[model samples]
Target: MNAVAVIEAAVPASPREEWLNRGKNLGAERRDVDWRLADWLSEGKAAGHLDQAGFDFLADNLGIGPAKLKLIHKAAAIPTHLRDTSLTVEHHAHVAELPVQEQIELLTEAKRQHWSDDDLRKQTITRKVETGRAAMLSQEEWDDLSRMQFLHVWNRASVAAREDIAELVSQSHMRCIDA
Candidate 1:
């Protein structure tokens, strides 16, 4: 046997080394596993297999930067059942802040529509606006108002539209206070 083969035979990979190898493989593939890796890392930490030092080691060795680490940590909030294998990590991250039911609904719709990350983001914003509007106005009042495209796309609204929204929100707040 060669010297490298003999050395490999003499020393086996430790648990941490094995875990790191698995993580590296998953990271390199870049599919269906952002959450999986996050879940494993978190489980390892919880099970006493990984401490802060170990986490730092993996982060350094695996090239997991702060942004990716944050995304992984956030994506972990999504339950395994809710995760779609076809979707990317960014897709899951977009809906991670939403409630579990909303998460499932949006993810289902996203998968059905083959939504990109931006599409999912716009949908999430629209959903939030609808929910917020529901809280601030009765169904009748909401229906009585003129339909404006700007209302559906707050992020792309013009300056005047923003002013109008601010005014409307303030008026709604005043009405609520008066009630």
Candidate 2:
């Protein structure tokens, strides 16, 4: 076939292919908006432009939940250069407390692999363990030692403290079940 014929015979991009690329572009835009909002939030709070009442008003006006606002606030710690436009705000939040170099490395790998937020979170935890910043309990250790550790703490508590802890543990158990 002639070059023109060969070119004409090639298939156009499929809808799925187009949508996948669009998703990446959309994610990048979303990341930029989130980063800008986070910066504004951090600056406003620090500059006395936003207090609790002001935050309440803003949250009400913007329809942003306290939890999401907290996450955005936490995300403000991440530097702009380390941000990957192809990742979500949550991805940045997960690595916000990490060192700048770690953030760059993690975000770069995440963008290249198209990792989900949960996948990124797991990877971050693993990185923390590797760097000795955190520890992970093995399944066997959790099964065998968790109850003993709880009992050890529980036994030394005052009656009032025990009651408080009981309430907290009850709430924690409910949260775990809901999760």
Candidate 3:
């Protein structure tokens, strides 16, 4: 449920972190969301994967802060054609054909690549299912996602000493010493 079931509560960005909120300065400009992120979400919807609640969670937690996120809550609640299971995407396919696992896989890969959902859907519609075959995701996408090299490993490590940290990032904003 990336964009279908949820609307995140965005907090406003402060001076130092303002760059990530899409827009924070010059007024009016801030209301618009990042188009690419929105697109990824829309694709998630078309694929029958994105729900409103999940999308809200991601936007609130990762993409924007609380105050600003909350501001867009109402606008994000609007329903779209993709939300109905009875309706076919592009006007075809049974409701059963839209597999949840496939949708989830598609969303995950798109997130990994930072792709808008619409981009993925267009690719699917124009290429994957258009070649006179049964409806299915592109084989290239499936193979790419399934490959071992595509795997990403994440683990946390511990560290000590503030000075050590500053030394490590001496050239960064977190630098301890005022060089």
- Which model scores highest in TM-score? 2
Candidate 3 per-residue lDDT over residues 60-170, each given as its tens digit: 668664333332332232234233222112111111134445444544455466554445544444343445433364464455434422232111223445445446666
Relative to the true structure, candidate 2 has a C-alpha RMSD (angstroms) of: 10.1
Between the candidate structures 1 and 2, which one is better when assessed by lDDT? 2
- Cα lDDT tens digits, model 1, 50-70, are 765776777898888755765
Backbone clashes for every candidate come to 0, 0, 27
Candidate 2 to truth, TM: 0.58
Against the true structure, whose lDDT is highest?
2
Which segments of model 1 are wrong by more than 4 Å? 1-29, 44-59, 133-179
**Poorly placed runs, candidate 3 (over 4 Å):** 1-16, 19-97, 126-179
lDDT of model 3 at residue 90?
A: 19
Q: What C-alpha lDDT values do all the predictions have?
A: 0.71, 0.76, 0.42
Instruction: Give candidate 1's whole-model lDDT.
Output: 0.71
Q: How accurate is candidate 3 locally (lDDT)?
A: 0.42
What's the true lDDT of residue 140 in model 3?
46
Q: Model 3: which ten-residue window has the lowest total lDDT?
A: 87-96
